[model samples]
Structure formats: structure tokens, C-alpha cells
Target: MEEKSFLDRMLGHLRETCKYYTGYPKYLGPSRVIHFTSEREFVQLLHQGYPVVVAFTIRGNYTKHLDRVLEEAAAEFYPHVKVLRVECPKYPGFCITRQRKEYPFIEIFHSPEQAANQGRVADPNITKYSVKVLPFNYDQSAYGFREFFKRHGIRSSPDPK
Candidate 1:
């Protein structure tokens, strides 16, 4: 009886150790859509010299549809474009400051020279970078996003090595 109890305790300890090591997966696979969680991350992404598509959304059917569309777009345009989703309900202050009155609004921020030179390295020390914010007015679809990128001269794919 003492040996059985001791074995049970060891198993329990091993289970807890395994649980601690394997908490939760950050992502399932190679997810291109980045969920916005902090201001520092936002700033770092913007300064990475890639066009960023920021979707401001709340919890609803629209958000669900937009999330799928954004994920598809991000996958198709990986490395060239970065997609970010901001849950308005979770960050009400950010949405309010942005004057977001509707759900699933998207804005694209890109450097002025990004269209001409997509490989340009952005200055790290510069607090203020020249960026163009273009409001997305097209339909919420992968094709629409492609058209938007094409219309704005934003590269949809990374350059071939």
C-alpha cells in the first residue's frame, strides 16, 4: 500500500510537470495574421518596413467573416504584408480613440517608399516614420484585398531570391 501511494504521487508530479511545460500553443501552424495585444508590438510591426493591414473589429458575425478573410490574405501575402486584428471590445480605449464607429474596419499603413522599394530597411531609432494610412473600402474578401494591394502598388508577394 505504501509503494502504491508513492507511485501515485510520482505520477501526479510528472503530470503536473508535463502540464507546466506544455501550456498552450501560441498558434496552430504558420499563421500569418497577428493578433494585436500590445502597443510595443504594434510599433515594432509598423517599423518593420512592411505594409501592415490593421483590422479593427468587435465580437460579431462581421468580425468572424473578416477574420477568415484577413487570415487568407495574410497567408497569400506573407512577408510582403502583415495583417493585424484588434478586438475593439477587448480594447475599447483604442477603438474609441481611433473613432471606429463600425465593426470590421481596416486600415493599411505603409511607408511611402515601400511601393517602390519593398526591401528597404526602416530606421530603428526614428520615433516618427513616414507612413501612409489607407482606409480599406473594398469588399471583405481575399480578392478584394488583392485588388487593394495592386491598386496601392503594394507588393503582394516577396521578391524572388
Candidate 2:
């Protein structure tokens, strides 16, 4: 028997710590897609050093495919980015407050790492447009999502040495 490395162990723990849905195969990625529970959870992701993408969705005709593509992309960029799906029905106010009225609205929030390097938190009292809201016509394909991430300073993979 061999001992699992710490990184492997931690990823294993986080993989099982998140959401699971039927009718979908297990994602073969380093990071897992999680559910957005609350503002506290959002803050926790920031505090935990993981950049988070929250998808506000409903049972619209386009949502299932949209979610599938989003999850696939997240898997492609695993460990570096975490994706959280939010069912707006459960928390309409959550989406409404952020002005995400359209279904499958995607919002990206900065990690503490980016916040620190960018001098974004000079004053926590003042709010900023730190969140990136994807257009309602946002693409739901892995390639499209990859492009979106790239344009917004998120990497689809880790840097080379």
C-alpha cells in the first residue's frame, strides 16, 4: 500500500464535499462543481482561496444544456476554478439583487489572491464591480467558456514552469 500525497488527499476530500445530481455522469476533473448555498458560502470560497463562478438558473429549456457545458468547462479548468450552480427559484432575491433576471445568468467573483494582487480591497467599506456578469447570451460550450475566462483574467489551466 502507498500513502496518497497531500494534494491528492485534499482534492479527494473536496471532490466528495460538493453536490451530486442524477442523470449526469461523474466528472473526471480535479475540481468539483458545488452548489451556492448562501452569501456566507460565497465569502467562504473567497476566504478558502478558490475563485468562484456562480450560475443562476431555472428550469428553462436552455438551462440543462447550459449547465452541462458550464460543468464541463469547470472540469477542464479544475482546481484552479470552482463553479457553483444557483437555482434562482430557491433564492430569487439572490439573483435579483445582482440584477441577473435572465435564466442561466453567470457571475464571476474574485478570489482573495486576485484581490490582493490587484489592490482591490484597499477599503472593504466601498463596494466595487469586482463581480463579472456574463451576458444573457453567454455561451455554454467549453470552448466558449474558456474564451470567456481568458478574457476576464481567469486561466483555463495552470501556468507552465
Candidate 3:
């Protein structure tokens, strides 16, 4: 296989292992949203130690995939931050909540990773927020998350790195 492809596989396997240890809902609290679709990237960022805010349209009419993402995030991290899985699909507009707004999409981000994913279209016309999006998947800004924290802040625990 190509070098990049091999790297991808390696990363995927590593992610799987990380997921196993990230702690699922059975071990978490209400502050975290399990299966946060828009937070897949965000959770990874958290593991890397970035503060972030994750928002999603949890209304029944919305996609189920998003729900799964929330579940995953909740299982992974809870009580550490605020996870808002909004049940309202449609916002102020008559337009369905699925509608994607323009750039600088207003959101609360505890970490730089979640802030970076803002307004980027990860899947299609649908912005990352519309789909079950992990914060990092929407944008690569979180790619530098590790260094960002190291330079400006300190994590109390022993960093696996």
C-alpha cells in the first residue's frame, strides 16, 4: 500500500485503541455528550488537551448520525465541559435548523480546536455542525492543538506524550 494509505490505517487503529480508553457513557456525567457527531474531532482535541464547545441539532427530525456522535463524546468525556445537544432542529429562521449559516458561525468553543472547525464545510453543503461532526474534522486548526497548549498553558496530569 502507499505510504500515506499505510499511515492512515495506522492512525485509524490508534484511534480505535484511544476510543476504548476514552471512557464511554457508563463512566461519564451529564457535562459530556456521548456520541457527539460534531465533536469527533473535538474529543481528539480534548485528549490532546484543548478546551472546546460542541453544539448539535438533536431534534427528532434531524439526522440520527449526529446522535451517535454525541453518544461517543459523552462516553469519552463528561463533567469536564459543557456539551449542548440542542433538540431544536430549526433556529430563529423559518428555515430548518439543518440550514447552514454563513461564515464565523456563532458558537461557544472552550478549546481552540472547536473554534477552528467553525463555518467549515466538512461533508458537503452541510457544515460540520449540521452533520454529526467532531470539532477537529471540520478544520485542521486543531492540528496544532498540542503545541498551542504546551506554549500557553499546563495540564495537571501526566501527559501520555
Residue-pair clashes per candidate: 0, 0, 35
Over 40-113, each residue of candidate 2 has an lDDT whose tens digit, in order, gives 67766766555667778888878878767776767766778778888888977778887745567777765453
- Candidate 3 residue-wise lDDT, 54-151, digit = tens: 45453453345455544545444344434345433433332244364532221334433333355655666442322222333332122232333345
Q: At residue 95, what lDDT does model 1 achieve?
A: 71
Writing each residue's lDDT as its tens digit, candidate 1 over 1-161 gives 34568887886667545422244322323678998898778878987888899999878876777776787678767878999999888978777877767777999988744244335458755343457889999977778888988899988786679
Task: Please estimate how well model 3 matches the true structure, expressed as its whole-model Cα lDDT.
Answer: 0.41
In candidate 1, what residue range of length 10 has the lowest lDDT sum? 19-28
- Stronger candidate by lDDT (2 vs 3): 2
As a TM-score, model 2 comes out at: 0.64
Candidate 1 pairs with clashing backbones: none
> Model 1, residue 125: what's the lDDT?
52
Highest lDDT: give the candidate number.
Answer: 1
Query: Model 2 off-target regions past 4 Å?
Result: 1-31, 111-138
Q: Model 3: which ten-residue window has the lowest total lDDT?
A: 136-145
List the candidates' TM-scores in order.
0.69, 0.64, 0.32
lDDT of 2 at 77: 67
Ranking by TM-score: 1, 2, 3
